[model samples]
Target chain A: DAGVTQSPTHLIKTRGQQVTLRCSPKSGHDTVSWYQQALGQGPQFIFQYYEEEERQRGNFPDRFSGHQFPNYSSELNVNALLLGDSALYLCASSLVYDTQYFGPGTRLTVL
Target chain B: DQQVKQNSPSLSVQEGRISILNCDYTNSMFDYFLWYKKYPAEGPTFLISISSIKDKNEDGRFTVFLNKSAKHLSLHIVPSQPGDSAVYFCAVFVQGAQKLVFGQGTRLTINP
Candidate 1:
C-alpha cells in the first residue's frame, strides 16, 4: 500500500507571500496532522484535521491554516509568510486515535 | 517553553553496540510516549510507542521505556547498524488534545 504523500517537494516564496502545501493520507487512514520542523529542531505540531474539520491546533498564529477533503487529502496554507516560516512541513495520517505515520515533508523556503 | 526535551544533541555508537537515547517531559499527564526515527530530507517514521499505563514496549530491535513518576522515557536500539544512523525524536500524546508534543531530536551515528 502507498504511504502518506506530500506535494511540491520544494518551494520558495518571499516574505508577505502565501504558500499552499498539499498532502494525501496513507491508505486506510482518516486523520491528518500537520507539523513544522525548523532546522536543528524537532517537528512542532501545527494542527490536526479529522472529518474535514480542524479538531486541534497548536501554538501557531492564525496565518497558518489547513483543510481536509473527503478523500483524506489535506492542504496547508500560510499567509503573510515571514522568513521564520521557512521550514519542513510534514503531514502525518492515522486512523482516528491510532499511530501516526508521516509523509516525506515539503521543504518551504521563505526568503 | 519546550515541554519535551532530548538533552543530548547527538551520539555515536559502534555497529554492534547498543545505542541509548533519552528523553524527559515536563508533564505527567501525557497518555502515550512514542519514538520516531527520521532520516535526512524525510519525515519521522514511527519506531515504537508505550502507553502511559505501561513501563515498556518493544518491537524487534527497538524498545521504549517510560517512567511516569519521573516524567522520563528512553529508546534503546540493540546492535546498532549503519542504517540506524539518523535523528530520533521522542513525542508525547496528550489525551483530548490529539496532537504530539515533540522533543528536540537526538542524532545517532552508528560506526562500523
Candidate 2:
C-alpha cells in the first residue's frame, strides 16, 4: 500500500509571490492535515481537511489556505509569501480520529 | 504560549546504553501524546504514544511514560543504536481541536 505522497519535492519563490504544494494521502486514509517545520523547530499544524471542507485550522494567517479533493488528495496554497514562510511543508493523512502518517515533505524556499 | 515543550535541545549517548528523552506540556486537557523521530529531508516518523488514561505504553524496545499530574512525558530507548540518532519531537493531540501540537524537538545522537 502506498503511503502519503507529496509533489514538487522542493520549491523556490520570492517574497510577495504565491506557491502551491500538493499531497496524496496514504491509502485508505480520508483526513488530510498540513504542517510547517521551520529550522530548528518542530512541525506546526497549519490546517486539516475532511469531507472536502476545512474542519480545523491553526494560528496561521489568512494568507495560508488549502483544498481537499474527493479522492483525499489535498493542496496547500500560500499567498504573499514571506521569507519566514520558507520551511518544510509536511502532509499527514489519517482515518477519523486515528494515528496520522506523514509524507516526506516539500522544502519551500522563499527568496 | 508553547503547548508542548521538549526542554532538551540535544542529547548524546554511547551505543548500547539507555537513552531517555523528556517532554512537558502546559495544558492538562491534552488526552493523547505521541513521539516522532525525523531525519534530514524526511518527515517525522511516529515512534510511540501514550494516552492520558495510561501512564505507560511500551512497544518492543521503545517505551513511553506519562505523568499527568506533572504534565510531563518521557520516551526511553534501550541499547541505543547509531541509526536511532535523529531529531525527536513530542506532540499532543487535542481531541476537541483534532490537531497535533508539537514541541520544538530534541536532537538525539547515539555514538558508536
Error of 1 at B92 (Å): 0.4
List RMSD in Å for every model shown.
Answer: 0.8, 0.7
Worst 10 residues of 1 chain A by lDDT: A94-103
Candidate 1 clashing pairs, residues 3+ apart or interchain: none
Listed in order, the DockQ scores are 0.89, 0.89
What lDDT tens digits, residue by residue, belong to model 2 across residues B1-112?
A: 8989999999999999999999999988889999999999888999998999999999988999999999999999997999999999999998988899999999999999
Candidate 2, which segments miss by more than 4 Å at Cα? none
Candidate 1 residue B69 Cα shift, in angstroms, is: 1.8
Report the alpha-carbon TM-score of model 2 versus the true structure. 0.99
Candidate 1 Cα outliers beyond 4 Å, as residue runs: none
What DockQ was computed for model 2? 0.89
Docking class of 1: high
TM-score of each: 0.98, 0.99
lDDT of predicted model 1 = 0.94
